[model samples]
Target: MLKIRLKRAGQKKKPFYKIVLMKSLSKREGKHIIEFGYYNPLKKFAYINKLLVYKYLNHGCYPTNTVRHLLYRLTQNKINVK
Candidate 1:
């Protein structure tokens, strides 16, 4: 199972995260299949690769709760409902 989750980085007290694609059994901060985006909690910033995200999601890659919420906001106005 592949997952979209945060990889911890940055210095102490100033947290930054890499939104990555990796296997479920792999170490949390270890190897990643791909890096699709970035999030800086302290700065309240997010940057994502929509095409990559869509491709992964279609392949059954599930994002962490925080990433899911961010994706929801980013795609809200652009997504169409039938």
Candidate 2:
């Protein structure tokens, strides 16, 4: 099954994350089908591309728990921006 989740990146002690689409059995950060967006925890920042995100979501892609929360947050922003 294809899943949507975060892959850890950046330097040690300064974590970043890429929201990705990948096969369920793949290793973390090994390979991904798509690199959708990014998150920086220390800065409390996120940049999610809603177009691609909803495209995957519409196609039955399953998101991780954290990614689900992030998407929930993004929905509000998209609405407010419109």
Candidate 3:
């Protein structure tokens, strides 16, 4: 099954993440099918491709809870994610 989730990136103390499309059983950091966005906790930053997200969602790809929450936060923050 395909899934939309976050992939860890960035530095030690300053954490970053990439929102990716991948297989459900794959390793957390395993190969991803698409990298559509990024998040930076320390900077309170997030940028995502909403169109791609919806595309995958329609194709039966589920987003992890954290990623789901991130989408909510994106909307709340009014960051023009689309």
Candidate 4:
């Protein structure tokens, strides 16, 4: 299964995350199929690729809980909820 998730990066105590597309069984920081965007927790900022995210979401690519929450917050105005 393919997953849209976050890969931790940046220095200790000051973390950033890369939104990545990877196989579900792979290591969290392992090779990824693609990088979608960035999330900076400290800055409370996120950069996302909406097109790719929507494509994957429609094709059954699941997002991690954290990623899903972030997307919900960011794209609430654009996405239709059932």
Candidate 5:
């Protein structure tokens, strides 16, 4: 099944994450279908393409726990890192 999750990136200490769409069993930083958002925990920043996110959501895409929390924050306009 297609799933939405975070792909770790950036340097060792400063971690960055790309919110991506990919096969459930794929590797964490492996090939992804698409990248629709990003998160930088240290900076308390996040960005998400709501249009694409909701589109995939309606099409049965599942988001990880962390991504789900981010989405909730997005909907509430709490973490607008764009």
Candidate 6:
């Protein structure tokens, strides 16, 4: 099953995350099918590709709990699209 989840990145104290698409059973830091967004909790920053997200969602990609919340938060915060 494909899933949308966060992949840990960045430094020790200063954490960063990549919002990626991958298999549900895959390793957290393993190869991702696609990386379409990112989040930095410390910075209260998020960047999600709405088009891709919706596309994947329609195609049956489920977001993890954290990713779900972040998606909600993205609507409340200022998102930076690239």
What are the clashing pairs of model 5?
none
The list of candidate 5 runs beyond 4 A from truth reads 77-82
36-73: candidate 2 lDDT, tens digit per residue: 99999999899988899888877888888788888888
Question: Using Cα atoms with residue i matched to residue i, what is each candidate's TM-score against the true structure?
Answer: 0.87, 0.88, 0.86, 0.89, 0.90, 0.88
lDDT tens per residue, model 4, 1-82: 9989999899989999999999999998899998999999999999999899989888888888888888988988444332
Off by over 4 Å in 6: 76-82
Residue 27 displacement (Å), model 6: 0.9
**Candidate 3 residues 1-82, lDDT tens each?**
8888888887788789999999999988899999989998888889999988878787778888888889888766422222
Across residues 24-55, which tens digit of lDDT does each residue of candidate 6 receive?
99999999999989999998999999789878
Write out the backbone clash pairs for model 1.
none
lDDT of prediction 6: 0.87
RMSD of every prediction: 3.2, 4.8, 4.6, 2.3, 5.1, 5.5
Tell me the TM-score of model 5. Answer: 0.90
After superposing all C-alphas onto the true structure, candidate 2 shows an RMSD in angstroms of 4.8
Question: In candidate 4, what residue range of length 10 has the lowest lDDT sum?
Answer: 73-82
Off by over 4 Å in 2: 77-82
Q: Could you give the candidate ranking by lDDT, starting with the highest?
A: 4, 5, 6, 2, 3, 1
Q: For this target, which candidate reaches the highest TM-score against the unseen true structure?
A: 5
lDDT of 3 at 36: 89
Clashing pairs in 3: none
Tell me how candidate 4 scores on lDDT: 0.89
lDDT of 1 by residue, 1-82 (tens): 8888899989989989999998888887899989998999887889999899988887778877777888888778343212
Candidate 2 matches the true fold with a TM-score of 0.88
Model 5 collision count: 0
Ordering by TM-score? 5, 4, 2, 6, 1, 3
